[model samples]
Target: MSVDEEQQPSVIEELTDVHFKFEVKEVLLELTRQADQENTLLALSVSQLGAEGKMRTYDLTITSYLRKVGLDYCEIRDSNNQPLHLISSSDKHGSDLLKVEYTKADINGPNFQTTFDNTEQNLKVELSSLDFLLHTKALLSTINYLNTAVPQELTASKDREAKKQVEKAGQGKTVSKGPTNSNVFTFKLSAELGSFRVEVCDDRRNIADITIQGIDGSVLVQAKETMVFARLRDIVVLDVDPKTIHKKAVSMVGEEVFSFQMSLYPNATEGEGYSDTSKVDGKVTMRLGCIQIVYLHKFLMSLLTFLDNFQTAKEALTVATAHAAEKAASSVRDFAQKSFRLSMDVKLKAPLIVVPQSSTSHNAFVVDLGLITVGNSFSLMSAEGFSLPVVLDTMDVKLTQLKLSRTTLKQGSPQTDIEILQPINLEFLVKRNLASSWYNKIPGVEVQGMLKSMNMALGQEDFGVLMKTLRENIGEGSKEHVLDVNKQVARDKAEQHQLEGNEVGCLPVEAGGGGGGGQPAAVTNAGGLGENIVNMLLNLEIKEVVVKLKKSRSDQKESPFLVLHVAQLGIHTNVRQYDMVATTYIKKISMKCLEFSGRWL
Candidate 1:
């Protein structure tokens, strides 16, 4: 029934009903009344029409059960004080035998009642359990309907759409912060990795370039445009088959441009790579970022291992070619094998590594390994007959302006040719010690054992120790730690200066004309080392030759054995070839050294 809003009542009557059907053999039991005009007594009878069942059996059973609990009969009424009359239907296909009608208001009314014989409390509990079961079944059915009725693609699309909106909003918020003087891109991706700030350049809404620098503003990687994703994809290919051909093109929209499996530490919560693109408020926006703490740590550890490997590889190569070396010197019948032992240690101490402006070469990349100090010792020993052991110890060998580059080869199997893009600014040692003595005085076996021990000391354990020390001194990510590191650096510099001021050997050499002074002059031209080398070669000015020899034996301030020291060496050359400039350098050579003392065996 429906009613108009104006006709609706503040409180409306609700209907509640209870129906019970009792089977008496093939017939149903229903409530009936006697035919007496003055009598108000109720009776039970078979409900099925044309049914013939004895009334005595059902009457006795029901009577005994009702009498046992004193719940005589069931009666129901409406809000009014009148009993609901029981009406029998002619067609009882789906009709209940005993049905009572009542209003919700009459549940507690004096005229309304429902009676259950012998097990009323149990029936009430069963009704509540049935209701709960029905509710649960309905809820499960609804969930199943949703799963089956809605397509998976549609659901996934909806989720992607929602995520896209969120990402776009975030992108807009970050990009709108404005640009600085050095960076003009308004859509820059700024992120912090430990104490380093990673700035990603935006190219037409794509992450095209990246620059990493310390918090102190020292650039680790220059802000040069590059195929960032392409390079990463190439690196990823190294894990698979390097010869496998893949799509070189990339895009910022739609599916991911590139993806690589990230190696994670055990029990890592997050590190899986991700990329996203979206459009919000009629403008397209995009984002690409990675959180790779574990991978970064692994890479740094690998770098340390690489440095250690350099020394090990040299020693291994020398040992591997020992037979060839002996064969080359087979003239003398008693000629024995010569062994070369080398020890090298390379460390990165607060280095400012930089990837300078992109190379103009067709297919090449440049990396400037700023200033590196290589501490090494070289020893050459011969066994048995002709025995002269030559040992050279180099102190603080500094290689500066060392730019390493790679150019992709165009022929044969895919390979990148490594090259030094710039001339290495090699500084001659301020101190050198060389010693060559008779090796026959020492046992050959003992000398070999010493070299073997040196090789063993350069194992992974030593590398691990070095890395641990570096990590300890690297400082934390916080500003406070950076401040503390800066203070420590200042203190170390002050101490170094104090010591240098007192030491006579550390004193600066005078810049004398014609023959240069003791100390090698610092490259002070603003145009850089390459420019200076080019200018010197073009001008052809021969001043002095500085010869720095490695030290051997003990590192005491003074040693008996001395190496050749060149005070001056002048070369004269004239241009003879018109086509070949470098080929026209055949000239007279004049050399001079202050001291030379060594045994000529």
Candidate 2:
């Protein structure tokens, strides 16, 4: 079983018996616009908050659409086999709609189970092809409405103050503002740590004030009038307390909220001149119950058989886009319904590892992480249309121990910069070094310029050819089946290995097949671009390596954790396939080192 699957039962047991129901219907909303020719359709001239306290109305229409287009009736139940909640359309919409139900079973014994039942067909297929642009516009419009929907007097005063601040800054004057001063735009949130508020002002400085207050309304944490800057062009703010967030969330929604972080970028359209492209980089932590996740996993596993059908549906939608979209929307209102059944079996594990030496002895590295968790910071640059690529200026990964536990890795004494751009358009540059230890002065390495899109990094045509080759060679099977085959192959090869032992033994043949000539099956099948791709992907280069033994507390010589240090390490892969299903490709890898001593095992 996968690691997640093994821990699924305990994760479910942590949940208390509870149910949830959600029903979405048509909501009529009124919106005001700047009274102009371009926005004159069905618009109302209502006073709104604007710069300089001006009452400017635009000619914009008030449009309303169903929020969740295809949802009908939904229901959920808890572990005690009792109904949690049921949500259905109102009497005005009538009775012919989708209905769904879920049953959560106890995880005490092997017989425990869970189930999901739905009566409709093609619901998910149609939902996948929705036009997200329209939905996004609607959501944004709603938020804008909410932000401006305040008392006219309050809005006017705030707008006038903001205008004065902007005018003063334009004249190169610093108008001092207090930390508690309210701005034109202010947002408040009740979180676990405390009640936090952020005030954004309209000025050249683009500074913001962040304050946290206790339950009694006393200030707890405050970052007053702070200018926002980041390594990534986008400015992101996160407000979350992992330890107490669950408790706070339960009081709000009555459910076990999972770990999550929120990111808000203020100036998304700062750099784009006229390009109509704005990037909103957000990290939303979904509060999906662990019990629900376990059952969802099982349901998805069951749907593997319908992969071909889904592909066919996608192609059909592509051919008749409008017709398929309309049909899918109608099906949700008239046919499909929600249905579910669930059961779970959770396994337990003890935390501590009994043998310390055994834990670190056999592996090259214990942990490997990149920009994923460095200072909780991220950089996001926008791309035109639907393509948003990620570019990492510098990437680093540390190995806990090299050859032995006693030795440590360190950086070089003198730092030297290196840049390598390959003939195939692959590039690498190392500019800095690693850290040193108290025992000695060491050398380090650094590499820069890590940016590429999955398909664009390797030309799309070349990537398609590579994927075709891989799919042909590996064939097709469920994930579990493929893993089983790999394990069996490793076992067979290990048993038949004879190079070191010098024992002559017959080579293993393809599974369920008779022995052929001495040629290996893999070589015979992997022809054409297969061999070239493997060779190109495996190429690695390293600069400068030093290995030394250090004395230990036991009064004897022992191997250090850092066995070798490379002044520079470079890896260039013309085409690296990181994902099989999504077919993601990465182009380059490079980095710098510590200041003291650095080495590898």
Candidate 3:
């Protein structure tokens, strides 16, 4: 009856308490308490949170850890000995957040305080180690995201490097700078191989390299991504000695080493650090002694190899079948002034090589292209007649003194092309039809007389009979009368000077009336040695020969074409006596023609 009578008001305070313990340095235990009179909790511990906290499996209660920090019974007193309290409530913060205040007191109540919100930083934790066997079985998905990115920074850096190259070696010429966009490379970290690989491929290039080792380790440090990125110098210090590593590359909670894995946007680095693996930049020189192109072709896959120096490689390329067909009709004033139309299709062969001529010189090379001609044609038109179409079905060409230079192919565009420098020498094996117009260009009289003489010399035609036909065509009676007068004049001159510079293989024959001393007299069928050895040129077929063909001195401007620049080698052949029989035959003919003068007349 008294207990019920004692509860007079509904506002009876209930007892509330909290406690904590800390086995910290020099401190056995600490605690935080909560009083039944006040709604606020108090720290009663003496140990610091970070200094005393260990990564150990212990109690999970909030009050257990809170007591270790020792926040209860901590207070400030004023001059009047008045106690002060930090007054804060969870309701002051919005939902999903908790705010707490630590206040200090002046002569007034609680004056200075600092507040903390627990929801400001968000951290994510994922554990894939729980299923390590699944990862080994290739059943885990490690790909976090797929992204396509343009590496702007990489492109700018590459362009700057290219510009420097242009200025360094260029002589008033702008080299073709190709597109700087590097091929897209996908990166993968495979738990199966325990390695990471970067893969890149395209029409121009391909690269698949393995890298990033020693990465499987325990984490020693973790920080907010915002703080790490924004204030990077605070976390990492460059120019540090290897000895004083603690000065900071990474500040870990323990002494274990940490491997850093950065996931950045694609536009960060210079997409790929390889322009050419052999030589990247600067001036380079190259030399080769007795090098063969066929070997280089097999080694380089495609055939073309660019060298920065004698040993430093630039680029290796394959032959592209793409051809450029050109049709040109122009007056070739160099030789016989012919108007010609040339339809040529230019094609490249794999493994074009330029070898130096001597040990001292480096500018020249032996250009070996194996073969190029397949369907090229040439046609010439002149005042004398028109030539039949000449087709280049198959041919091989070797050249010397070849040079290389850079030129802009598509001006104002991104790339450039390589062009051969001028004055190249060519050795050729060309097969084509001998146009009848070529022989027809000879004067009709000269052609008729030469054919008749050649036939007589070969014993195929009668020399006496040929001379009789020619005399009839030219009116022999009048010719003989003029010859008598010329013979008399020659006789008078023979008396004045000695016969030192007489006609080759012939003495001046005294005519009955006049003499025709300058011209070669007609041959007669006298059955002599000269008749058996005529036309020796038709007896031999020359397989190899060298002919120097040059343009007329009057042509000031030159063209990069076979027609205008065929200098050291050509299709023309020179008849040379290789056999003893041919040599003997020639000597007999020369001696017989001089001995028997009246027979030639």
In terms of TM-score, the best-performing candidate is 2
Ten contiguous residues minimizing lDDT sum, candidate 1: 123-132
Candidate 3 lDDT by residue in tens digits, 1-601: 6876676422222211333344333233322223355332222323322112112121111211111211222233324663221121122222211111221112111211212111211222211111011110011101100001224455347545754654443233343332232221111112111222222211122211212222232111111111011101111112122221111111222222222232222112112321122222211111111222211111122112111111111111110011000001011111221112222233323234432221122222223333332223332233343332221122233334333322222335764323333333344434332222233232111000000011001111222322433344234334534544466467548744533554321211121111342122211212223212111122222222222112223456322211111111212122322332322112112111323353321
> What's the TM-score of every candidate structure?
0.14, 0.20, 0.13
- Taken over the whole model, the C-alpha lDDT of each candidate is 0.27, 0.26, 0.24
lDDT for each residue of candidate 1 in 340-380, tens digit (9 for 90 to 100):
22233443211222221111112323344445455544333
The runs of at least 3 residues in candidate 3 whose Cα sits more than 4 Å from the true structure, single-residue gaps closed, are: 1-344, 354-572, 575-601
The per-candidate count of clashes, in order, stands at 4, 74, 21
lDDT of 2 by residue, 93-160 (tens): 43222222212222232322222111111111001111111121133233334434444566448646
Ranking by TM-score: 2, 1, 3
- Give residue 468's error in model 3 in angstroms: 68
Give the higher-TM-score candidate: 1 or 2. 2
Best by lDDT: 1
